[model samples]
Target: MRIHLVDGTYELFRYHFSPGNRDREHGATLGVVHSMLQLVQDGATHLGVATDRVIESFRNDLWPGYKTADGVPPELMAQFPMVEEALAAAGFCVWPMVDHEADDALGAAARKAALDPSVEQVLICTPDKDLAQCVTGDGRIVQYDRRRQKLIDHHGVVTKFGVTPESIPDYLALVGDTTDGFPGLAGWGARSTATVLSHYHRLENIPDAVGQWEISVRGSSKLAATLAANRELALLFRRIATIDYTAPTFEHLDEMAWTGPTPKFPELMAKLGGAHLVERTENLRRHRDDDRPQ
Candidate 1:
């Protein structure tokens, strides 16, 4: 069976900014939970959603400017705890990340789920560049961009980024991710960064001399000099983008499968002003019962 892992943090942000969700109360979190449940209803058996319980992760200590909750609105931040509680009450496996962020949890879960023999595929439900590193060659792990409705495999990564999935962290390091607050080396843009990193596969392996480059790329000399000058910073940035695959472990695929809502779902839904969800779930349960052979 295909195991689906979701980046709840990204989903919340997407829904918050989405046109259809702007005026709804707690719409982002409710929409995210609804969307995830729809996935299960549509045949996703094993599912997991990772959320950022605390915006600041250990990575913040590694880099002072890493993304944090400081700039997030009070309304948006307030929904995080509610989202986690709602997800848990719904009987979905929610990883409310504390020490690590949602991205790291998703990556770690993907790696762990990919190891299970019963899992036919592991679809990471996010377009986050950092999560791209988790894509594997065996087709076990892949990324699904819900907004674009694109399923990005290893080959797709190469097609989109001009480099293999393995080179993504390195590529992002050179191009920089403003969302994450890591400034890449100067003079590195998408094309130049892809051209060089595609060949070298990593920052450390790139030849120091421009003339030594095996593949001919534009502005090779300038790229080399920039790399030489900011080698340490570039590596540090890459480290920030790279996902840690060893955070939490899940040995069994069954651990992730949907088991229906928790006992406290009724009360929790009431608190979140999600009475509609509770009613729908009860109706769904009744329908299932009515369908069962007597």
Candidate 2:
């Protein structure tokens, strides 16, 4: 059996800028709920969606420039609560992260689901780079970009980033993550970062001096000096980039089960203005029950 874990924050962001939803009231939220329902239609019985109900996570305190809800349209911000409520009402296990970011929940879920013997594969439904570290060696866990229909396995991680999954944080630390708002040291760019991290596999593991460096790189003298000077800062940035698996998402895997929508689903559908979604959900619920093992 396969379990599908979604990043609700990414979906909501994708829906909001999708060119069509701006006109419809609560359209992005409607599209999000509808998109999950389509997953059910496509044969995902065990599924979970993690949302960032409040955009300001503890990361904001760690770094002042960390992402916040400051500039997000009130319309988009307003839909977060409703999205959690509606997804819950629709019978999907929803983890609305507040203190931690949404990816933390996803990492926790991926780890827990992989421990289950019945779970043949776990598909993390997001394209975020930080989450790539969650990919496993056995290929039981992978990242899926639903928009592009792309699957990123462990090998794909190496191919795309020129480093192993374990090196993603180091890569980000050197190259800097613009989205997360930590500026990497000056002179570090994608190619140099990937080349060094690919060999060292971690910031700490890299030799501090250019003379001791094993790999050939362009402008190694300047890059090596910058890294040595900001070694402490680079480590802090890596810590920032790494996902916290121990963060509270849920107690057990069963908490993520998707039996069917709750009784309040009809009301939620009404509020979200997606009546057609309610009908499809009801039909799928009945059919799902019928197919369940007695």
Candidate 3:
């Protein structure tokens, strides 16, 4: 069995800006529900989606500049609950993350699912750089980019990032991610950061002296000085980028199984003014019933 884990937060953002303006109020919710259903129709058996119930997380207190709800558009923010309800009404397992962000939920689910003997592969459905660390070399857990329609395994991570999956957090920390609101050390770009990190494999391993470096990189002096000056900040940024697998309490794959929709799914859909979603739920139920012995 292959387990599919989706980053609901990213999907919501994508549909919010997508053209056609299909729905002013419920377009994102409808898009994400249809997308997940399509995945199931495409043969994904065990699936899970993680959404950010609250934009702020424990990481916010740890880092002053971590991504916050302050910058998020009100339109997009308003659709989060409706999206969760739509997914649930569609007979899919949804993790509406509260204390932890969606990234953490994805990471935790991937790690937990990878341990199950019944699961052959775990596909993390996102292009987030932070998820690279969870990719295993044996193809057990891989990252899938829906936009590019590509599956990035461990080797792909090394090829794309110029460093192994293990080095991605360190790489992102030094380079910084505007999406995550963590600014890395100054003077660090893709080329220089990859060169030094690919050799050292981590921030702590890199020496402060430029001459002591084993690998060759352009402008080693400048890179070394910037790293030395902002070493603590770089580490902190890396911590923010690293997904916490230990946080969520879901211990077994069985815990995530989709028994069916909540009892309130019908009423919930009505409250959101998504009557079409109610029809989709009925269709899903009929399909499931048809698969069973009659």
Candidate 4:
């Protein structure tokens, strides 16, 4: 069996900015549901979607520069709860994250699904860099970027980041993640960070003195000096970038199965002026039911 874990927050952002999607009464929320239903139409049976109920999380307390709702457009911010409601109404398992972000929830769900002996593959549906760490060997679990039509397995994670899956948080710590709003220490570019981290694998493992370095980076002296001076800050950024697998998202893959839309789904779709989605989901359900043989 295979499972699909979706980043509902990313989907919302994608559809909201997509061409000709802004004007509809509830376009962002409805478009997200339609797209997930497309995944169901394409043979995804067990699925879970994670959404950021409130943009700010406990990470805010850890770092003042952590991401928040302040930068997001008010119109886009407003659609969050509506997205959760619509997906839940459609019978998809929805994790509406509050203290933690959607990324951690999807990671936790992926971890849970991959552990089941009956599960063959777990596909995390997001293009976010933070998710690359969750990818595992032999395609047991992977990062599926639906928009790009790409599958990033463990090898892909290594090729992309020049480090193992275990090193991603360290890599992001050195390189800084503008998306998450955490700035890395000075003198740490992508190439330099990857080269150093590919060798050290973790922030604390790297030697503080440039003279003791085994591999030579472009500006090792300055990078080492900056890192030595602000080692605590670097570790903090790594902590912020790390995806928490123990996010209390799911325990069983069977719990994520899409049984069919809930009774209230049609009414919710009508309320959103997306009556067409009701017809689409109904047709898809009929096809699925017809295909199931006794």
Query: What overall lDDT goes with each candidate model?
Result: 0.84, 0.88, 0.84, 0.90
Q: How does residue 32 of candidate 4 score in lDDT?
A: 95
RMSD of 1: 2.2
**TM-score of each candidate?**
0.93, 0.97, 0.92, 0.97
What lDDT does model 1 reach? 0.84
Of 1 and 4, which scores higher on TM-score?
Answer: 4
Given candidate 3, what's the lDDT at residue 219? 85
lDDT of 2 by residue, 43-142 (tens): 8978889999899888787778777788888888888888888898888888899898899989988888898899999999999999999999899899
Model 2, stretches more than 4 Å misplaced? Answer: 22-25
Best by TM-score: 4
Estimate the TM-score for candidate 4. 0.97
Instruction: Estimate, for each residue in 1-294, the C-alpha lDDT of model 3 and write its tens digit.
Output: 888899999999888789964776877877787788677656666788999998999889888888889967787899999898778766777888888888899998998888888999999999998899999989999999988999999999998899998898999999999888888888899988888888899999999988888888888899998888888988998888889887563556765554455667778767766666666656665676577587
Global lDDT of model 3: 0.84
Shift of residue 227 alpha carbon in model 1, Å: 0.5
193-268: candidate 1 lDDT, tens digit per residue? 8888888999999987888889998888998988888899988999989997766635677778676787799887
Which candidate number would show the highest lDDT if scored against the true structure? 4
